[model samples]
Target: MAREGRQWSDFEIAVSDYLTTLREKAGEPSYRRLAELTGIKFSRLRDIFTKQNGTPTLQEFIDLCLTFGKDPADVIYKIMKDLEAKGISLSNIPAQNDPADEANAALASADNGVDIDAWADRIKAEDSVHEEQP
Candidate 1:
């Protein structure tokens, strides 16, 4: 279903590339080490790097940023800049008026034992449903 989009978005491509480059620059011997360092599964990291799946969730992205000693907002800015350079304007992306909304949502999901991946999938499903409507 994710492949229905004609390939990963520019943001995904940029983020995947950024992560791959960061891994190399950090001298991380393998994804296993990265997984150990970030507490994210090796398969998940592999999926993100290989683009075998869709983009990672904001939490996963933040984990990668912190693992690479980069600021999440700064990395997001870089990805946005890269996308703009490629003529991919995502200016229509909505902004959250309440920053705590994300934290509250994550906490609520965790209280139900829902991991980030599952939560992301749920959100994606909801988004797809909304997209199909008028």
Candidate 2:
């Protein structure tokens, strides 16, 4: 079943092409096997490769790439580049925040080398003295 006319985004086109190449390189294994390996539905795998489905969900896309021994991150980076080229404004979320100077200074000002073992021993001794009093 050929979809003669459908507009695919650059990301989709790139992903589809890469998947096609990988499929070919692996001697074109059965879609059933691909589904099992990727943990995706057999029908969905078939639909994606056959162009019956125009777009794959994020999980499907990632699983397919990883199942084929390809890094999903690599493909995702390409998609990011493609989106950038097309002037798509994606939110730039960072994995972690850089520590502020104030935070660093506060940490530096705090006493870090307090003897935890001595403090614990002293607390235990104080607790024993209280228990004896009662």
Candidate 3:
């Protein structure tokens, strides 16, 4: 079961439902209040939970999960399992083939089997790149 198109995972659906429940419990306050509680910025919290632009950062996701009294790992695993059930591979995530992967490949190809120093340098470079991105 491998699907090509994007679809919400069971975890996503469940989280959405859980968010809705929390909203009701909190009397459906504005996203601003939700952000205040979840520690994500107002716009970012809205974007992930309401606007559906993209997934939230791990910290935001975990915070939101905790707000709903859900275990962060459990929720993440559920979402991943749900995605797999829908034919979506975890490898489909855009970061799967990031430059880190290339560096890992390079290390794997080292004549000495893997230059640790080179790998560390490559990882540092990638981290810098990540930091420089908006």
Query: Please, what is the whole-model Cα lDDT of each candidate in the order they appear?
Result: 0.81, 0.76, 0.69
The top-ranked prediction according to TM-score is 1
Best-to-worst ranking by TM-score:
1, 2, 3
Error of 1 at 21 (Å): 1.1
For each candidate, what TM-score against the reference? Answer: 0.61, 0.52, 0.47
Q: How many residue pairs clash per model?
A: 0, 0, 0
> lDDT of candidate 3 vs native?
0.69
Stretches of candidate 1 exceeding 4 Å from the true structure? 1-7, 94-134
Sorting all predicted structures by lDDT, with the top scorer first, yields 1, 2, 3
lDDT pick, better of 1 and 3: 1
- Winner on TM-score between 2 and 3 is 2
Name every residue pair that clashes in candidate 1.
none
User: What are the runs in model 2 whose C-alpha is more than 4 Å off?
Assistant: 1-7, 79-134
In candidate 3, which residue pairs get closer than 3 Å at backbone N, Cα or C atoms, i.e. clash?
none
Residues 69-114 of candidate 1 have per-residue lDDT tens digits of 9999999888787777788867676543577988887787777664
**What global local distance difference test value does model 2 have?**
0.76
